[model samples]
Target: MSNRVVQGRMVTPGTLAELIEGSPVLETEDITDADRPCPECDGDVIEVGYMPSVTEFVTGYKCQDCDWSDDDRE
Candidate 1:
């Protein structure tokens, strides 16, 4: 799992606990083999952690050279 910080604060602190306590545990199976391309640089998305808002899980990806993120997409 990956952790992200914005302005030195977590984007969604305690996201995992909220997911485990709210969403069904079985949902984890749905994303076990999924791979989403980076919306910015078309890099491989790496599993960061669970964030139901973005799928049942939210991922982060970076370009090897540019280090761009999905949010950084132009």
Candidate 2:
């Protein structure tokens, strides 16, 4: 898997997913560029799709330069 740098640290897909999820995940997709600016600092953003639990899927967004994160979860 291709690892990406976030907050100056290299992180794999699973690690990044956990970073955003605030816990371990069941599964994860490859990391991708979000093609969007960070809402907090205008930095570049990345995206990852993961299963936080068996019954839920979430598309998580996080900043590469700062502590900003969001997710598409209902």
Candidate 3:
């Protein structure tokens, strides 16, 4: 099966298992470090944890001085 994104919408052409199994896996080193300032308060943003998932594929980051999170960005 094949998947394509047309005009910002993804056209699903396969099963859910196919999509999950075919998805790319990333390591901690492969992800960008959270060192930028937070958008809310100019606080130091740091890597707090990772996204909880069946595969646990992505990193989760937050600010040191504020409650800002990078979860939605992923």
Winner by lDDT = 2
Candidate 2 residue runs with Cα over 4 Å from true position: none
* lDDT, candidate 2, at 28: 94
Worst 10 residues of 3 by lDDT: 11-20
Which of candidates 1 and 2 reaches a greater TM-score?
A: 2
Candidate 1 per-residue lDDT, tens place, 1-74, comes to 23434323343324322333354322222212126665665644433233445344543333322334342224
Those runs of model 1 whose alpha carbons end farther than 4 Å from true positions after fitting are 1-34, 50-66, 70-74
Error of 3 at 21 (Å): 23
TM-score of 2: 0.94
lDDT of 2 at 22: 96
Q: What tens-digit string does per-residue lDDT give for candidate 2 at 36-56?
A: 899999999999999999999
- As a whole number from 0 to 100, the lDDT of residue 51 in candidate 1 is 47
Q: Model 3 off-target regions past 4 Å?
A: 1-33, 49-51, 72-74
Tens digits of per-residue lDDT for model 3 on 1-74?
A: 23333223443322211222344333322123365788998866544223234576444544546546554333
Estimate candidate 2's alpha-carbon lDDT, on a 0 to 1 scale.
Answer: 0.94
Cα RMSDs, all models: 9.3, 1.0, 13.3
Number of backbone collisions per candidate: 0, 0, 0
**Each prediction's TM-score against the native?**
0.26, 0.94, 0.44
